[model samples]
Target chain A: MELIDNVSVAKKANVYFDGKCISHSLTLADGTKKSVGVILPSTLTFNTGAPEIMELVAGECRITLKGESEAKAYKAGESFNVPGDSSFQIEVTDTLHYVCHFG
Target chain B: MELIDNVSVAKKANVYFDGKCISHSLTLADGTKKSVGVILPSTLTFNTGAPEIMELVAGECRITLKGESEAKAYKAGESFNVPGDSSFQIEVTDTLHYVCHFG
Candidate 1:
């Protein structure tokens, strides 16, 4: 994604991954926490405790939200929202760059 | 940074940082290794064993190559080359997103 001119780096930036995907967390000036990450080719499931907006910074992926019958495709510059306390599955055909905003 | 379509994620990505900066290593399809990272506001020095191309993906920083008397500033979309077996200093005034390609 293009750089935002006014964001402040987190004082204690940390990296998170489990070999399949990787990401770093940062806190903005207004105390909003976000993570920018890359997801490799895999079919993975994730559970969320908070609402999330996942923005596709690069590449593409197919996402199947909870209770959904079919998966949806999202490419670069697109985004998908997941409700709090919900789960979703992502089928990545290629390396995908994403920024997840959590609330 | 905008993700390249042909690049493949590394099978084994390990996070690296000393609380000042955070990055994850990825290996491309052609076996080239690259790192995507974020640097917080700080002045830090790094040594390289191989030639490196540091691409500024987001924010800005002032960099001083070894043996240089003055520092140069680079912003998003800009890049700088560092020679192998040399060291460079980076003065970051803001959160900086970067991708480092090693050869």
Candidate 2:
């Protein structure tokens, strides 16, 4: 869906990589935590504490998980999984809009 | 309150000035429209079709409304208004977090 409904959104944003990445935290009705965010065209490494599902809403990116040599390209309407306590390098060719599900 | 509850948030972001400013559209249950956004440290001009109340959640900036000669400084917990069909110039010294209420 294009919209996430009935959630509480934090007014303050999570800014990272010098504002190359920006996200707003959300708490769903059942207490599920998620974030809607944007990543401008940039190559950045992100470390994860909780396993995450990066669901793309728009734009394009290439992702390389830690210890992986080959990069996988992902675009709008695609999703990628990253392991907990691991990291990934993402090269964004276009501005990326995504919802991150964390647990 | 620090959070806006029971609202629907658009997954896609509104990226402006090449990502210097970013915001997400939100719809309240009563159909009131609002946005939560971030503006990185930069000077930018914004035009308004609807009158706006920009409520600052954090950071600092100086604002000059359309046809105004003097700029006003605002910080966290402050707010500023801009009339419809007018514009404003904002010089952000620190990254800005805000909620825009439009009518």
Candidate 3:
């Protein structure tokens, strides 16, 4: 096993969308890389605004957009497709952790 | 987006083998969950002993055992099957970061 500690890896740039931090980072490689992400626990709430970024919650969390389809539970270890330009609301019955990327 | 901060999540146990800290954390759920792990930058080395835990390094890292098959490169974002009981040595030509998990 090789351990690489204390080395500086490139950090993605962060863009702000209505006071929310939208960080984006591209891999330092050249190819069709696979998508992998981890959604750690946080307390960010989404309103009727930018909606491409969907929060992945765990443990019986429900997400329902006002006047949209039925409320759906964001199951643990499962993923939800983030609508690019739709305003949606996500409510978690408990704390959550989620990490994802667009490759 | 749900940001779940400041909440105490269950952390996994740490098992040390030969002065190495193998800290682990299981999700606060119960089921046949898919595996997800992040192998951040570390400086852990492998020798002619314990070799089940393979490190995933990026950027043309070459791994060679004492006397095994021809040395192969530990390509970035690509995974190498860690021989359960074979020992190996890794040499990275540059700094790196890698994260992977088994399901």
Per-residue lDDT, model 1, residue B20, is 53
lDDT per residue as tens, model 3, B2-102: 11111112222122232122222222123221112222223344542322433343344666765776767676556655554455655555433332222
- Choose the strongest candidate by TM-score: 2
lDDT of 3 by residue, A1-103 (tens): 1111111122212222321222222232342211212322233345432334333423335677656778787866666655544555556554333333332
- Write one digit per residue (lDDT tens) for candidate 1, span B24-84: 5544557676766777678999888999999887778999999998999999889999999
Chain A only, candidate 1, TM-score: 0.87
Question: In candidate 1, how many Å is residue B3 off?
Answer: 1.4
Lowest summed lDDT across 10 adjacent residues in model 1 chain A is found at: A4-13
The pairs that clash in candidate 1 are: none
- Lowest summed-lDDT stretch of 10 residues in model 3 chain B? B1-10
Give the clashing pairs for model 2: none
What class would a CAPRI assessor give candidate 1's docking? Answer: incorrect
Who is ahead in TM-score, 2 or 3? 2
> How would you encode candidate 2's per-residue C-alpha lDDT over A1-103 as one tens digit per residue?
4899999999999999999999999999999999999999999999999999999999999999999999999999999999999999999999999999997
Among the numbered candidates, top lDDT falls to 2
DockQ of 2: 0.78
